[model samples]
Target: MNKSNIYQCADCHTGSGTPQALQAPKVRTHLPSVTNYSCTDCHSKVVVNAGPTAANVTAHYAIRPTVPTSNYCDYCHGPNATSPFPARNKTIPQFAHDDPGWDGNATCRTCHTNSSVSADPLANDTSSFHELTTEYGDAFNGSVKADCVVCHVQKSPQFVAAPNPPHDISGMAAPDCYGCHGVNVPGTEAQKLHNPTPTTTGGCIACHSNNATRYYVNKSLFALHANVNTTDGMNNVTDADCKTCHHGAADGTMGMKLGAANSSNTYFCQDCHTSAGTGPTHPSDPNLIKDGLSHGKTDCRWCHLAGDSQPRPLSSQLRYHPNGPRGTAAGKNCLSCHVSANLPDPPFHAPGESHVSDLNACQECHSNADNHAVTPLTQNTPPLVSGLSVSTQITSGTPSQVQFTVSDPMLQIAAAQYQVTNSSGIVFDWTNMTGTFNSNSVTINANIDTSGLVGNYTVNVKGMKSAPRTDPSKPYYPLNGQWSSISNAQLNVIQPTGYDNGTVYGTLGTDIAGATVSTNTGVSTIANSSGFYSLSLTNGTYQLTASKDPEYYPNSSVFVTVTAFTTITQNIILTPKPTGNISGTVTSK
Candidate 1:
């Protein structure tokens, strides 16, 4: 606390050249107590006025052992036994968690007058200890730090304070326990690394050895650990712990960063067990997961041995596939994450639904999956989609989201993806139409720019599936099917408004008012009594037809072309056939 007494490197180190072999602070450098928080480590501020000293202090000031030590606090808090407080140590008052002022910042000041005297920086620091209060920060009132509980019992007074970050993780008795098992100790990345045996018969080391230099290459030492599953208390296993002993990163990479570009990870399994090695080895190199697909998206343990003292299948030959396909007992045993009873997912798609079938692995579509091939409807009519339509506008120079609706029967609406060709005939991928998928109705909310768009734009929509997009720029797999109607719409950007319609005026000449006239796009209307009729359609070629009366023969269907919003006149001729024709049967073998 004495500024003049604080050691300054500048005292012996002039702005001149380097000193000889031995520095003046040789004695202090060897001192058992020099630390960043110690008086010897901080330079005296009295030299602040001298420009060279200030520059040296600003540029060269450094503490080798910067971390605060137990003795650092003794500088300002040395024992004052001559006064009222009875101190134990010759350098400072004896500190313990049980003191009356230990938990309260204000209460400690009552006894020690030094501004920093009561401020203990070691384990006695009170910040990590939460007090029991009405507004304990983080709603963790009354919670005590594991480090404190490891050594001391709760004091007379209780206070609320948030526990230190070191002790905040769940399933940990104390942060100190990280040396052993770690996360999802019950089932996490560190769970596998969390094994700690109080007895000398350690677990992971039983099979894995780091001190390979220490003689025991004897098979007996390692073979014992092959199937023993020691948990990290939480369900997670720390990959770091695994890498610490196992030479997993022969390539020198650190994390298990997954992606197609990081393909080297695909060969990581070979670093340890080796190709010549045996059994359920890493599922790559001719992996259990086929195709250029990835199994990185899923938890590997989901399909591996899980409970009841089962050992990991030592060899791939001892594969564990507990289910069949399509919610049946088809038993091709995918070992998928689905419950053991029903597998291959439900309401499966037709074989052609997926283009990636060659990839043929569960992880292809199900791993961290989204977007699925909708169940294919046999025909594009009915139940496929009704009134497939949309309304759009350019708001604030940017095209507002084009809103469209389709009947959702199963109510398991996911998402919708679309594509459109602009006026210049340039085809481009539209934004993924994802957001709210209301039950019984699928709505697409998407935004597109139309400022440069001239002619007309055609938009098509398809339902999203649970399959993840392997190539995100394109579409998720199983995209071959799904959706009743190819949700299509034509909205003219700058073209003048015109009616796309035609008249089916030449009727059977009967009560034409009830005669039904329909267009190719499933748009249907009735004819007037004067045999006058018209068809409303978009700018496209369509097949035109008139429904036949109960007493008359059906009219022949005719193809017509319509553009923009235009009304075109077309004549339909209906001829009635004679009553009945005699038929004779001829047989040939």
Candidate 2:
């Protein structure tokens, strides 16, 4: 390791000597003619004061290469274990040939060329020492491993000092596929052997066995699995292969237990992955299709994409929808996914029945709006008859009738029925009731026997839709179906000549037009201007009183008597209180 040169290139370069003196070449190093050396040992000590020279390798000229022959200079300058370039002499300026950063380990033909090129560079050549320059150049390439440690290391490219002992790699990482099949190239083993893959020609048990190299990494199983390349040359492993070679296999029938009873396996996939369906109402419940004949055959994502639970139609699978599988905006497609038979009227039958026609008409008899549940039409809404009115006076010799309007909100009522309650407490259905279809109003002749009495009668009217029930015992004569809604009116009977009617008149004040006049019989009427009021009382002596305001003196009751059907007059005035109005505005800052 001495800096002193035996063949003194300094003498030829700058040490005051010979033919090479005029030009200082970039390289100058030689072997001492007197020193012990060998052509077999390319590493024979000859420090490069300038660099390796012809004198240094002159001994290897006549030598023939042996089997597995390689570039001799690589032993000292390449990336091999024996390469001492890393710790070379400080002033020598480390390098192989011309370039200061030259790499001595590369395919020889890259720096040396011939047309007889073959796969093995060393075996293809047979040249003399002087033929070295003509056959081989001093060029360099950096694309490959700078030094040949990529091939020479055999196990790993990571170098370590010895005597303290290099790490065995055994406990570094455990059960990793890349631990043993590690590669730095960017391809598969089948593509390039130096490249990587999860492949193991001997199968899963081969690397997982006692004879396997015990090495590992600190990464998680998922990360390792995600990065594993299962390309060509991968171990021919299958479920059966694992079971056949396993001493302890996964237990349980429906659920997978990946080891002996409780002993968990390193393949910690949690048995079931937790990533597929994660929404709160993601339609992932298996029972959402409890008795589903077809819908139970797919993953939830097929229908619940973007979280809309109203599954789109996969008509081919269920055959429920007439149209082929298709999706609608925001999952509002309802009819295609629904195929239930429910109706609201009698002959109440399921759909696809003999009586049921167009399925689209479901809404006519049931709740059919999108997102709505099926509810019976009759139960949800009812037809109603309102705006009832009747003629008060029964004409002595003319026919009389009751007129009223009907509003059928449900449109279920096609006809109406009525009953007349007379003073005798006997109720009879109005058999002569006729309705004008367009206006939806009914006209029924009261058929009042004007000679019976002089009192009030009741007309009860109702609306209904025919129920078409098959049972003969059911009430069917008057009308059918259920009464959607009901209402009533009053009919008054009066004799124009026989009984005597009397009128009483009175005055409460000067400006009381709306003051009420009443009798104990519950008959009441309002007063006109000048506070003069009148009422007709039938054959009875009546006691009447006038109404007064809160500030007026109380009224004095009036008594009036009637002898015949004539007008009887009784006038009275209400007095006022002693208090007077005191008005003013009071303001404060």
Candidate 3:
């Protein structure tokens, strides 16, 4: 076998004799340098030529720490690996490529970079981090937008990284919980913390505990604090605070704080100050009651006035008097208007011109308080007339006697005298006078010869008062003073001398028959057989007239002139006048 035909492994290069052999390093013959020669020209026998091996390539293509899970890939692809290989066409795991820059070690820059890993799932971008979207979105929609400081540090210069690390897994680092729940610390170190009381549970336990001190303190402190300075310590607080103790106080119950009372304390000044049952005492002033003075209590409204909290002037406090003569010094008396029952005198007299005792009582003008006046007795009577009325009735022949009655309802008859006058202007002289004069009426009787009188005559009755004589020595007449024409009555006399004939007859005409006539005087009369009127008459002229009944003519005498006793036939014609007849027919056109 040829030595040139020995075979060697490519990796370990263990040699073996075969047809294909590993050649020794050969010496190249020098050839002339040629320009622009292609590499394929001499490498035709070598079909495969790997690219030149890289130098420091691992360091140049190091995986970035920001790529998550790429550290696992660096284990195999790193330069220190026995057979570091490139991931030429392989797919990487989901988490394997995450946090690529992280070298599985801690460093300031490692975490400072954009590739820093966060333990909070909320901070991860690819893993549905909710810190930016969900929490902030909910806060924006809520009534109170979430403020970072409400749950975080209360004050600044907060060393977020020292004793209390920036990322506190214990969740107790927030200072906001100290507001309601007092700080809790060891008794030895109590001064270091604010409000270091055992009443509070420190840190997150104060808020998140099953029975948290913050919850209990917030529930009770508002009401307990309000009771500090009230009349009744529990009396006046807000309804919300009262609801802590009385659960229904907010919805209206007896437990409501600061509620108004059902009744109010109110009274009138007159009720206690006036002269009533148990009233205030005052001194007596005689001048007040005597002058009918308007005392202090006269006008209650003057002091009280009208409206709420109206102020009374200091000068108006004194009482005013209105009795004397309004504005006159003597007229000013307090008791003139106000009764003694209502107003009493003041303790001491005011330094002024006071009322005097001689002032009249109220009875002088206002007889009594109820009906303030004096009434006089009066009686109504008819007016008195000094005249007389005389009535007379004369029957045919003898003189008639007249009765005279006089009245003076006011008793003025004793001073009166009467006279009568006729139409002839002659006064009826009182020949015999007998009459009695009383308080109301008087009556007298007088005889009068009324013979031969055929007409009416007026009797004027007049009255006059007997006046005292202007000169006492002169003779006095009965009618002297102012006289009144009292009244007059008329006297009528009828003639009784005419006589009637003893017979009467009826007259008949051509169309007037069966007519009857009779005499009106008390005498015998007859209708003659010839129907002609005949009568005996004294020497005088007479008028004779005739009338027909239903269907006859009437007749009348022209005139019967008789100078002596003679048979005068005065004839009357009974005639019927023709009544014109009118008849016509109406025709329609």
Better of 2 and 3 by TM-score: 2
Better of 2 and 3 by lDDT: 2
* Candidate 1, lDDT over the whole model: 0.37
Residue 209 in candidate 1 has what lDDT? Answer: 38
Model 2, runs deviating above 4 Å: 1-359, 363-377, 430-432, 436-453, 467-478, 484-486, 496-589
* Candidate 2, residue 9: how far the Cα is off, in Å: 99
Clashes of each: 53, 6, 36
Deviation of model 1 at 416, angstroms: 1.4
lDDT of candidate 1 at residue 381, scale 0 to 100: 27
When 1 and 3 are scored with lDDT, the better candidate is 1
Q: Give per-residue CA lDDT, model 2, range 329-348, as digits (tens).
A: 12433233222221121111
Per-model TM-score, in order, reads 0.27, 0.22, 0.21
lDDT of the candidates, in the order given: 0.37, 0.37, 0.31
lDDT of 1 by residue, 406-504 (tens): 543322333466777756664667446665542335565666666556556787766643233324343222343234446777755553222433334
- In lDDT terms, how accurate is model 2? 0.37
Off by over 4 Å in 1: 1-277, 280-386, 392-398, 405-414, 436-441, 447-455, 464-485, 494-589
Better of 1 and 2 by TM-score: 1
| Candidates ranked by TM-score | 1, 2, 3
